[model samples]
Target: MSERKKSLITTINNQRKYSQVAKAAVLSSAMLARKNSSSRGAPGSAAPFGARESIAAISDMLSTQHKKPVRSSYVESDRVEWALKIACTISMITVCLHTPRTIELFPPLTYIILAADFISVSVFMLDSVLRIHYEGIFRCDSSYLSNRWSQFSVFISIIHLLSFLLHCYQLIGKLHFSEISLILLFSDKFFPFLHLNYRVWYGVIRSIRPFIIIRLIPLIVKFKLPKNRIEQLLKRSSQQVKNVTLFFVFFMTLYAIFGIQLFGRMDYHCVQPKTDPNNVTIMDLAIPDTMCAPEGIGGYECPNPMVCMQLNLNAKGEGFYGMFNDFGASVFTVYLAASEEGWVYVLYDCMDSLPSYLAFLYFCTLIFFLAWLVKNVFIAVITETFAEIRVQFSEMWQKKEVTLDEGFRKKLEKTDDGWRLIRLDGEVEAEGPKQKLQWVSSL
Candidate 1:
């Protein structure tokens, strides 16, 4: 459509939205007033206009059903800005936690989380910078440059603190910052050299493990952050981050492979006494073996039907037959089953023993049913919950209403896109917890 046509359409819709909202609000207030009046046994309860008021109130409530939240201070301040900060922090931390670490004994799979963190941080940082650079912070009673701590919110103040510390930290370290680098943490000042927004650097600060996981309120706030038009931007960012992250994972995998080979050939075996843990230890060789199990369980006596340890390889490795087209289920199932880090694996742990998609659908049915029952039959679709949250928060923060809380579309898109994202949503659907009863009845 032409710009003029689009503008007209928008104007009409916005006008309609305002009217609907006003009518609904009026009705809700009228009923609430009537209920209070009746409960208090006020003389007005018997008034002739009482029925008329109630009827009008009902009409208003019905009219307001489809209306959106008003762009008031209550909704804007409490909703939009806060959600943005919280969501950005959460996204950053989630990404960072799954990413690989430079140090051993740290969670091995944290790199995936770290990759996600980088993208999340950059977007949030952009928002923070935008707020700092463009918002009417100057109009407030406090000075922007002077008394930096005055009249700031826990959320905004936290973002500011994180951005400053991280940016300074990055500049401090002479070494280059990788996605997982703790050094180039977050930014405080807007980068004059790179022209990057300082606010985005705040997201990096959010990834600080102590801030996210250790601080419960901050963690919850981070998860509840809002997004804007940058969802598509985030999608693209997620892909870029994942690709870069995968490259690192590949490198690490190769490194592990080499480490395995080096450790494997160390000639540290004691055939005489096999039961001792310290005798001829070899951790490196065990990695690949752990990753890729035996070919056929080698016809050895089975230890357990379900356990991977039961699988064994043939003792003898002769010339020709060793090169079978298939090495059995070991390299595939057992290795794959054992390979995923516990955190990664837990996602699928409660799923049905079926293919991922069906299992996912089953999971969704289960969670929805549970959450619905718990919420007293008020089934707030994920979209609606988020929409309400965004509206409420925007008012709380006293910020401009964000454009990204198109709740239904965003949630639906998340559900329909990529396998992993889909799996997550599918898991949220309604699967009744009464399956065991059904089985019992059938039996």
Candidate 2:
């Protein structure tokens, strides 16, 4: 062959070798990445495949070898599982609908509710057991028992067991069993003086059945968009949320302390004087416009000492109901005022009781800080965090798309050898073999 032709062939051969080497390198890197990913059994590190896992693997192999393949037609379908879940949900809803009054008034409904409870509890127990067996034994997950779902399952089982016993007690009560026999069977007749009313205990257990609705959380979390967004929001904004909460609590406590100091002992209320025809004075006839403190305090005396009764300042005149009875009560009252719900009444009471009108300033300042400023700040923080998270997700998605596009372009470039060959033919036609030969020789 001519020197020019040989030089051209050598140049093409060199290019082909370079392409093969680059492809090999890429393949090798990909394989290495896959190996590394597969080797990593846990976060941040590789886990050793232990002897127990080896034994379990061997047992699984032996079991599968002996096990007969089941027909797909006979297999339990997802629809069946979902049906059971729906039924369980309905049963739980029925249980929630049953109140003590309903059970008492409608005697026959009690048995129906009991039956529903039994079905729901049984389904939950079965599901929990299957989950535990699958996660702990079949999957051989050591941390399965420590999982929140597993813990919740265990809790549900315990409560259901107690509820089942209560059901039995309730049934026995319906059977008209003697109280003495019941006390002996349950309490071992230890406290004969203590009244053992199984009915009341049964009612308490029934009340707790409403909490079974929490089981639906797993189903609710199946909604990917909302659930994932909520999870991301919480995870990314946890520190910000904590900071806001701390600030809110600190300010609330400060306002509550101020409230306690200002209105702690201000229990004065307007009381109407007695109007008797026989011994009626002008003061007695006058409307009770003056405020009087609770009895035993040396405060303003009313016109009718015999008949002036202390009026109830607020509904439910207990410590908790009082606006500023104690530190805890003051805190709750401050929360109410900050929420701006029925706080005008409290403000009026405070204004009426206190001699000065500075109470308005205190409340206005509290409302401005907590209700207006702090509330808006909290909303803005959450909104900003959500926006940031959304932007980050969008950027990641764009990067992924760009990477995919680059990979696709590289694939097209690799596959279009015919086009390259055609271009090379054109180049040979445009510049004769002698010129190509000289170029190759120079290279």
Candidate 3:
């Protein structure tokens, strides 16, 4: 082997030498690793045997099967999750960008990616169950259920588990040619709509768009952090949510004001003016005016239309809804795409607009979904960093470690350099006075 190849093996081997686990991995994969030659190709090329995976498969037994530590590194779990997730993300990007406009290549690759996702979901299932088993719901000291890790794990695990199962059902069904078209029709997002409760269904149908769900892994794993770290993270996330909420409220308040001031007043027409003989407009849908109808029956009888400014069409250049309009017709005839003509059509009532009442529901759902993404997905990442910060703060607070014989107060003295607390000998230096006493409430 060349010097570079030797160096890489040396580095990988050296890194693995710390833990017995790593040592086993290096030894087991040694022959497999040696086959590579830089002259032939890249050092870390794709595994000739199969797709590359550095993390060992979860299907392999975990020797230390004791309850996972509360503040665990989850080094293996995180590594595996990250490895597969990155692969899934890359493959998705590849299919979208370079893969040809063909049926066979797409489905096979899609199945592989989805299968990888299935494995990830399975890992989550195992993790959640293990966490629950380790951290029992009911504690002897406190009758109340535990808050640290397992509960949150169960909650997130259930959501993703259900998602995985539903996706799996669709995947299996799609393998059959007859179900392929239907699966293609409904797979990406409609499952959520179909599964949504009655209260949430309208919101799902009107504004739901397919989202790539790669960013949710770390989020579900967060509550497993140590108490101080969890508290600190929660504190930061809560603040962020508050700030975001305030910004959204202000933005939307302005948006609403702009809509009211800038939008023109309307002469009411029928809900479907061309289709319905009975005259009914949005105003009629809201108020049963004598002018709108002599009989008081506008809201009860008016038809509800789900309309969008249709852009980004499919292969046939069509929208998501199947029966919304006739396919192959003038695509722009019924649907608008924010063009001047489309805007004019909406104004003239040629292009239908969705009910304003439904928009609020969609808007609220979007806000919650975005908030969840930001808080759970984005904020969870800061836990480890937060933990590191906590460690620093803690060390700074505890100037010296107090031995059992020493005054338990951990003596504090205010001096020129600010309040300093003495720590135990050979421990860390205390940077500030001892904290005021606070009693813990019974759990």
Candidate 4:
């Protein structure tokens, strides 16, 4: 009887254990079902289990992820950023030295420049490829090529790449990459013409390369110089610079039109060849045969001091008005004149037939109004903006301090209303009473 009672107790214990396991399984299954239902309703949980991405998606991923492989580890690093800046500095210097004028001055410098260019181009090309990968090739709305600045950078990089290749071509001569004997033999004949074309392209590219200085300017401005006073000044005066630039454009356009009217129909002439025995060879004269006076004694020769003549009122070719037909040329010429660079030559060329007083008036107007008055205006505006910016920065710093004290974190958020600064705390609602209050008080 004692053994049978002990066995019954063991069986009861076993049954209780089994009941507990069954309860656990039921509870777990119920919980899983609830989780699955919730997940199905949740946003961004619609993807089917183990579904493969489409070929287009995979292609895009491959294209966009080329840089992603190293981006986090290298690209955003401060060390890399500084390295890039150094590379840009190198590039800028290389570009300056490689200019046709500079190269002409120092021909042997091309080899050194070519070496430097290789370094610069390699850096820029790698960077450009990575940037394009990051921005995505086919993203029309937000692609690498979409932003004007990005486009400028990529374009500059490509042109520089071509320039580098051209340099390599010149250095390598008729050396063939492939083992085709026909190409190798005939390359001697074909390469010179090809190189000549390349030189023309190289010149054009080099001329445009200076515009890369625009890209370099911003980088230079942002550089952390020892004093940082210049940076502070530039940051403070940014708004003023923008405003003044706009006004200057408008002013320049107006003056350019005025300049076109004054010097539109104009030309320069040479001594009447037939009349002057010193010029026995009529063919030798630069002036057209029609422009020279007859061989008679009383023939009207060009003026002694100057040989320039006024073109017919409706005349074209090389005159200010003829050039003005293109808007870009007109603006460039006017601004070029304003810079006083070949302004004297242009002044002499334009004013040969016009009154001397007109020259005085034109120079005075440009020097006094554009140079002095306009310059002072910009200076004043920049000074005002600088003061305002200083105050603005001070206020911003104070606000940041206050937020830190209040245990609040501010973040930039892009909403329907556009980018907005908002506190992370529950105290500030996204676009409700708290935001409205903050905006009103800040104003």
User: Which 10-residue span in candidate 3 carries the lowest summed lDDT?
Assistant: 51-60
Residue-wise lDDT of candidate 4 within 186-208, one digit each (tens)? Answer: 66467855534224455566556
Please give the range of 10 consecutive residues that has the lowest summed lDDT in model 2: 418-427
Error of 2 at 378 (Å): 2.4
lDDT for residue 240 in candidate 2, whole number 0-100: 87
Q: Clash pairs of candidate 2?
A: none
For each of the candidates, give the backbone clash count.
61, 0, 9, 0
Q: How many backbone clashes does candidate 2 have?
A: 0
lDDT of 2: 0.60
What value of lDDT does candidate 1 attain over all alpha carbons? 0.39
- What's the candidate order when arranged by decreasing TM-score? 2, 4, 3, 1
C-alpha local distance difference test of each model: 0.39, 0.60, 0.40, 0.58
lDDT of 1 at 294: 31
lDDT of 2 by residue, 1-443 (tens): 69999999999989967765554443333334334655775665652423222222233223334344643531145764674467458657776666668877887887786777677667667766665655563354444466666687567666866776677666775554787456545663566455554546545655655565576666545532323344656777888888898889989999999998887845454443445433334354326344444445444444554343444343344335536867878988889988889888777667656643557888999999999988998998889897977654553444334432322232212344431111213333547798889889999
The model with the greater lDDT, 2 or 4, is 2
User: Which is the better candidate, 1 or 2, if ranked by TM-score?
Assistant: 2
User: Candidate 1 — which residues are off by over 4 angstroms?
Assistant: 1-154, 169-204, 208-276, 279-443
lDDT accuracy of residue 298 in candidate 3: 24
Segments in model 3 whose C-alpha atoms lie over 4 Å from true places: 1-105, 139-145, 171-251, 265-443
Q: How accurate is candidate 4 locally (lDDT)?
A: 0.58
